[model samples]
Target: MSYTFAIIGRPNVGKSTLFNRLVGQKLALVDDTPGVTRDRREGEARLGDLRFTIIDTAGLDEGPKGSLTARMQQQTETAIELADALFFVIDARAGLTPNDRAFADFARRANKPVILLANKSEGKQGEIGAMESYALGLGDPVMISAEHGEGMGELYDAVRELLPEPPEEDEEPEALGELTDEEIAKRPIRVAIVGRPNAGKSTTINHLLGEERLLTSPEAGTTRDSIAVEVVYRGRRFKIFDTAGLRRRSRIEEKLEKLSVADALRAVRFAEVVVLMLDSQTKFEEQDLRIADLIEREGRALVIAVNKWDLVDRQPGQIGALRTEADHWLPQVKGVPIVAMSGLMGEGIERLMKAIEEAYAIWNRRIPTAALNRWFEQAVQTNPPPAVSGRRLKLNYITQTKARPPSFVVFCSRADAVPESYLRYLINSLRSGFDLPGTPVRITLREKANPFAHKRKRPS
Candidate 1:
């Protein structure tokens, strides 16, 4: 039962910078530009001996009703509602602005314990600004530099006073040891929703949550950070990550966009199953293929989601055509699951969830060693490795080293001489024979050492 704190401030007041410092990681995107964080990001924060949950929200600003700016403020307000306390941050170097004063009043109305943070208070100018913050009637501002790591001792003291005292500890139970297979299966699956800009990645997640958990707009690149949320479908829990829309490297010129793209890539690497969302109007594009290739290379289970299905003009064979295109365009994961849905309309959500579970099961599938060797023997006999450099390539045996992408190692003669075409042939055969669809399979070739070579037979 960790207490939660929401950091509230105007734009570019170093809220995200403070979040990164507290979390001890760059989980939230930080940039010089204002309004960089449109979504409220949460992280486990620790200071001295205190531990709690911290949420970094979008800056509070004035906007016309129903505009994007207004929606951003709504997100900040929601963060405020969920928090047990609030950290009201202000830029000490810039001093207090009218917006800061107005938001200070707003924070007061919430009636939560507010800890005023005068950020960027490192120089003489910052001290003057910190003094100015006292006029807002929010109590003495805790002067600190989020970026330069100054005055954290005073900040820690302020937060410590607000937290309740710890309860008495009971006797500890014995260690439970390793978890059973059934217990492990009950854990949440980590899935990442990624695609090109304006692909409705956030909309899909918002639909799943049945709330506007993330900010979505027609404008491309609305999301700049990878935001993770939990969802339970049919008694199965999923920790899904809504990542920034990735774009082609050549087109990304801005420093902020580059950071966003890097954050999305990190999400992919951390996810167990990656759902590549594509706009139905423009499915199977070049960038989509590249993203899929990257997922395969990373050895994660993949599911292709064709979003905005309602917008497409229905055809008799559209579903079948989508399957064919998925197999043809992306042959690496030949039988990858593809679900067509409208994220806005909430259509086909169940099918998408089912496909994700199925893909995850396949990714973790492992075959018995005996069955693997039998299949390996037949596959080799069907199309034996071609003779290389006038020497026969003898494939002795194959064994599955591990699962979670189903990796294998093959001991053979002249491992280096095996052609790339031969390896591809073996990999494809393994996929079809073992029912390993849509999961990346790895096969490593190792040369078998001759027994007589170690003995000095030439001396006789």
Candidate 2:
């Protein structure tokens, strides 16, 4: 029976700062730049013994309909509609501005309990602003500094007064044991849709959701935060993340864009399967390859989605040509899944979902030790390790240490002397032999230690 509070204010008023403070984490990005948050982010928050859900939203602003700013305001309005109450924050140091007065009426229109917070009230100057905030007709203002953690007690009291009484407690259910593999598989799959700016990542996700759940525009970098939404495709649950478009480092001039890129990279690392969306017109470009390489380096399962397929001129064997190009560009992940589709028109969506599930299954695949060793024997015997410095490298055996991007370790006589070319050969052979395609495979080399070496070598 937790209540939800949506923090709303004009830009640069410390709304995100208060959100981080209540959630006890830096989940929301905070910056001096106003409108740094373009989407509404929700988190479970706690204050003293009280627990509630908190939503951090974009600052309220006015823009023409269909513009990005207007869309942003719409997202904030959605958050307000979903919340049980509103935390109308104001910059105490800046005093009340016309925008603040205007938006105060906006918050009033929501018809929910609103807690007026006069933030940044550390010095005497902030006190003047706090006094001015009282004239907005929302009620008394709680003077607090979200950064320095002041006035939280008063804010907590205001929030508790608005919260409804909790329902009667019920008998607690027995704690469950560890989940089995099948049960774990039943859980939602975390898939991240990532790519360069204006690559239709958000559009694809919106198509899957069959609604404009996320704010989308033709302009690049419209999405700043990594917003995750849950969807069911063919009865399979997937928690999909819509991330900001990644650009080249040289082009990332603004501090805000840098933060957005970092957030996107974090999504890649957090996801189990990543769909690298590419524009059909600019498929296999340098930036696209770089993004794919980063995904491979992160060891997440990879799927290549050629978006805006309708824009492309159709030709015979085009799909096969795309596959060939993918293998040529990303040989490390040979046989990766590639789906060509128009995100805007919702074409090839079923194939994209199918490819994602197959990639996930392959990513989590594990090979039996006996079969792995047997395949290793044949692979090593067929293409034996090359001798270096007139000494033959004796390869011993291999074993799978883990799965989820299957990793292995091979014991050998001279681990350091093993050529990368030989390792690549073994990796490719392992992929073909064990039916592991697209997922990143890791192999660590270890030198077999001599048992009698510790006995002083007989004073040789």
Q: Local distance difference test, per candidate?
A: 0.93, 0.91
lDDT by residue for model 2 (119-184), tens = 999999999999999899999999999999999899878877877874344455433346678886
Q: Per-residue lDDT of 61-159 in model 1, one digit per residue for the tens?
A: 989998889999999999999999999999999998999999999999999999999999999999999999998999999999999889889999998
Instruction: Please provide TM-scores, in order, for all candidate models, with all chains considered together.
Output: 0.96, 0.94
The root-mean-square deviation over C-alpha atoms between each candidate and the true structure, in angstroms, is 2.2, 2.5
Give the number of the best model, judged by TM-score. Answer: 1
Model 2: lowest-lDDT 10 consecutive positions: 167-176
Predicted structure 1: lDDT: 0.93
What's the distance in Å from true for residue 452, model 2?
1.7
Which RMSD does model 2 reach against the true structure? 2.5
| Model 1 CA deviation exceeding 4 Å by range | 167-178
Q: In model 1, where is the ten-residue run with the lowest total lDDT?
A: 167-176
